[model samples]
Target: MSILVDKNTRLLVQGITGNEGDFHTRQMVAYGTKVVAGVTPGKGGEWVLNGKIPVFDSIRLAVNARGANVSVIFVPARFAADAMFESADAGIPLIVCITEGIPVQDMMRVRNYLDQKGVRLVGPNCPGLLTPGEAKVGIIPGDIAIPGNVGVVSRSGTLTYEILYALKQENMGVSTCVGIGGDPVNGTNFVDCLEMFEEDPNTEQVVLIGEIGGSEEEKAAEFIADRMTKPIAGFIAGQTAPPGKRMGHAGAIIEGGSGLAADKIGALEMAGVQVAQHPEEIPGMLK
Candidate 1:
């Protein structure tokens, strides 16, 4: 069984009328996810995407009327934290924040509030999570993935796609692939997803696609070294990124010598995880 979502997951799209919202919402609905309702504040009385799903004014109304337990936020960055808190207050069990550009301070505050309220958050600036051949919660390219025994967790969106493509080239498929977001302060971390994968019966091996960022990877290595029973292969991106400058990922910045690619690679290697020097080498390491 997959963690977080399954065939029974009922989803709600916040900002379902926006370009990003409408596009991914249609894809998700077509992929067999139960998108029960949507929310767009003043656009409550209006319909979205040919009126396929009902749109409401707030998370409270959406959850109250449609039993929406999971929410995917496509709202803009400035309002993402507010959306998250709204979902939390509405008692939504799972909230995926797909919006990018949310300030770090705002994320910290939101995270703290979520922790206090016991809410599960997936991303702040992420591609989102997918249970292959099942429900998808974010913006990941669903076409590239197929359901199988391998589980994947990544920080970078495009890099997750690259790793999945590589695995597919090797005739391997994924049980689940989670883009846990590239934000410094996110709801789920590598270790959190790893624990979920470890308990998932369908997953045989795991792939961690990370990038130069906070000490999250290093912390995950320590956790894996001590607790994980599954074989893990890892690849850290941004090897060529200039120091102190953010790479393609918002969280991929080197500060105080902490978030260097080499450092994360070393930590993973020391934890007995196979480290892929190049992205292409990941599938080989997994095999």
Candidate 2:
């Protein structure tokens, strides 16, 4: 079974009227995700996708009327935090925030609020999650995946796609693919996804795609060494990145000699995980 989403997921777009929201909403629907409704303040009583989805002014209204158990945010970064707060207040069990560049200060508060409210958040700058042949949420392309037993978690959306495509090329597939995002202070982390995959009976193998950043990979390594029983293959990006120079992701930087790709790779190897030298090598290790 998938960890965060599946066939039962009823999703609502928080900023459905905007361009990014509009485009991805169509893509999700085409992938067969049960997009129940959308939320756009002051655009209530409107319809989109050929009048298939109804838009409400607030998340509470959408949740009340359409039973939107999951909410995905597409609003601007400045408004992204508020969107998450609204989703939690509306009792949305899971919230996915796709907006990037949200201030770290705002996310600190939002993270605490979500923890207090017992809400699960995916990303503030992410590609989203996908359960192959079941549900699609966020920006992850669905065509590259197939229904199977491998579970994937990643800090990079582009690398996530590359791995999935590579797995598909080998006729392997995934039970779930979660892009946890590459932000310094976003919701969800490697350990959280690993715990979920460890408990999922449908997931026979797990693939972890990490990068040089915070100590998240180290934490996940510890968890895998101690508690995980599933066969795990992993890859860490940014090996050649210079210290103190930020990479493509805002969170991918080395400072004070910590958060190095080499360190992360060593930790995973110590945990008995078959760490790949490159993204394309991941699928072979899993097999």
Candidate 3:
């Protein structure tokens, strides 16, 4: 009952010949993800990982040959947008983009195209999603997550890992942990993930980890108040960050006094969410 991905995911890796792609592909395989195929353009017909997975010249070929329903992109920033377009055109329903530093203008176009095509994009600068004890997509470590009822959605990659580790230590497991990314124009938002989590039968509670920048948290708070029935615990990062400063993420910046940490926390609290002061406090709050 994971939200997006699970053990049945037949995955294909775009840019699988590159260093990052090759390395993480093996890690995903080791974690028991059904990595059926890969795409590396000129390296078609070759085999990687000791000849276990077939490499294709394009996503269309990979999908047609192996029934790859999920595509994970590891290409560079410059080529990421085109890779996404290719995947969508090739009929890959879900695309996860892990490459960072993509131009905002490029992502704007990508988002529009994906919406028009009815495709789902996880990230252009995200850590990807994890379905514990089932499938591992993107770069989220598979070791820290175990199958359970709580659903996790976060805007920060590193903070997601920290919260996951703490939950593991407390013997808490998650159904799915989605890193929607901290990009200004990235695909999928907190409200989207929250909706999925709300509809998922296996999810009994939700933990939302947000940072400064963007009105995403505020928007999610509105939705939580209006529609959500499950108990929610939250943590907002960048409480001490000064105004007009860009934090670690491209979208993490204070602008025109709009994206203050206090404002987001207030919104969530008013919606009846238990807000945690620290990442480690999240597990207890959820409990």
Candidate 4:
């Protein structure tokens, strides 16, 4: 089984009236996700996308009335932290913040509150997670993934897509594909998704796509070395990243020797994870 979300999840869109919200929400619904309700303050008492689901004024009302357990936020960055707390307060167990540009300090505060409340968050700047052929909770391309036995977890959204494309070229299918996001302070990390994949029966192998940034990869390596019972193949992006320079992803910046791609690859190698030298080689490594 997939972790976090499956076909049974009931979704609530926070900024349902916004353009981004409308776009992805329709795609999610079209992909067969159970989008039960929406929340948009003044837009409450209105209907979204063919009047399929009811829109409420607040997250609390939507959660309470529709029994929504999962929430996907499309609110602007200025109010993203509040949106997160709103979902947490409403007691939604899982929340995915698709909004970008949230202040770092605000995100830290939201993370602290979520920690205290025992809430699980996916991203504040992420592509989200998808359980192939089951349910999708973020902005990942649904068509690229097919239900199978391999699990993919990545830091780069585009790289995640590349990995999936490579895997599909090799005729491999994925059980779940997660874009843990590129934010420095995202909700989920490599190790978090790894743990979930380790426990999923459908996952026969795992592909961890990492990028230059933080000690997250090192932490994940240590965890896998000591705890994992499955075969893991990994690839750390930005190998060609110029020293003392940043990359495209905001969180891909290198500083203080912490976010180097070499360091992450070294750590994963020490952990017994097969490290791929190129993106194109990932599928072969998994095989």
Candidate 5:
């Protein structure tokens, strides 16, 4: 019923011994994500979360021994990209990197490698994706999401949470929610998530949570105009963003008439998308 993951997903954590990794790994397990294995390099053979999960030294070992189909990275910023590469090379089909602050150049290389290897990479600086009641792969709080028909793709972490909460308030549960990160060069974008949602029969509609920076919203608008058949409710953050000021990220900086809230809003409206002015308005738009 989800885009990228489901109950059959064999999950593993790459930095499972670290504080963030250890905590979320247990959370994911408790949420019934089928967390089968974990990787912590030198801390192989150690048990995390009271010996319920087995840890390995490398992703290859986790995949080979435990059949880890998906790898979620909670490594530090400097090693996040390498962790992603290791996952792909180890034959994991889906890689989700929850680590923030990874260098853009490193992501660029990871993207290239992923393209060649035909792997799906979710985020380097994101909250990650969830399939609602079926499965959760990253740091998104599992309790807030319910099983439903709406699909969500967002760039901002806090904004994603807000929109999801609004949807839940309306009793509209999501089929999938993907946080594609706010970085300029991330593994996935709005377009990629849109295509997947469009093809998923469980997803009846979509909500795009975009920000003020980057032409991603414009590009997503173009894709929706030309290809998508599902109804989409779109929201672009940073309406109050200062002009000539970068509201959110390096990629969010407004310059030379690009990445403006007005322009993105205009594009989405032109492409037949219903635009929400605020998070509270998003649930109404989806209806």
Candidate 6:
């Protein structure tokens, strides 16, 4: 009952020949994701990862030849928007863009295109999504996840990993973990994953790992209060972060008091979501 990916997810890597792309391709294969093919323009007709994956000239070719329904973009940020458009044009239903620093305007167009085609895009600066014991996409560590009823959605990569580890350590495994990316403009948002988690029968609880920026968390809290019935826990980072400073992530900038950690915490608390002071406290709240 995984939401986005499972054993049957035939995957395509858009820039599979490059350094980051190649490394993660191998990692994904080792984690048992059905990485059927890769796309690297001029490298077509070639084989990557010791000839295990065939390289295609285009996403269309990869989808045509490999039956790839999902695609991950490891291409540089400058070309990430194009890669996303290409995957959508080629009819890839699910796309995960790991490249960071993509211009906001480019993503605006890409987002519209994806919406028009009904594509599910995970990120542009993200750790990717994982369905424990089922499929691994993006860069999430496969070992930290275990198939269970709790669904996790996060805005930070490292924080997501930490939460997953704590959950597994406490024997509270997850159904799906989605890193929706922390960029100001990208594909997917907290509410989108939350809704999916709400509808997933396998999921009994939900965990939201948000940061001190963007009303995305606040918005998600509103949705949870109104529509979601699943028990949810939350942990918002950057509690003491400097105001107006961009904290590592492009979207983690605290402007005025709108996107502060305290505000996020208060909103989630008001929505009846247990707010955890630390990720370790999250597993306990799920109980």
Cα-lDDT of candidate 1 = 0.88
Clashing pairs in 3: none
TM-score for predicted model 2 compared with the true structure: 0.99
Query: Alpha-carbon error at 56 in model 4, in Å?
Result: 0.8
TM-score per candidate = 0.97, 0.99, 0.99, 0.97, 0.97, 0.98
Lowest-scoring 10 consecutive residues by lDDT in candidate 2? Answer: 278-287
The runs of at least 3 residues in candidate 6 whose Cα sits more than 4 Å from the true structure, single-residue gaps closed, are none
Candidate 3 residue lDDT tens string, 124-169: 7899989999999899999988889999999888889999999999
275, model 6: CA deviation in Å?
Answer: 0.3
Candidate 2 local lDDT, 1-287, one digit each (tens): 78999999999998999999999999999999999999999999999999999999999989889998888999999899889999999999999888888888999999999999999999878999999999999999999999999999998988899999999999999999999888889899999999999999999999999999899999999999999999999999999999998897888999899999999999999999999988888888876
Cα lDDT of candidate 6 equals: 0.91
Which pairs in model 5 have colliding backbones?
A: none
Query: Which pairs, if any, clash in model 6?
Result: none
**lDDT tens digits by residue: candidate 1, 52-169:** 7989999999898999889999999988889999999999988988898899999999999999999999988888878878899888887788888889998888888988887887
| RMSD of model 6 against the true structure | 1.0
Better of 2 and 5 by lDDT: 2
Reference-based lDDT, residue 174, model 4: 93
Error of 4 at 150 (Å): 0.9
Stretches > 4 Å off in candidate 1: none
- For all candidates in order, the CA lDDT equals 0.88, 0.93, 0.93, 0.89, 0.89, 0.91
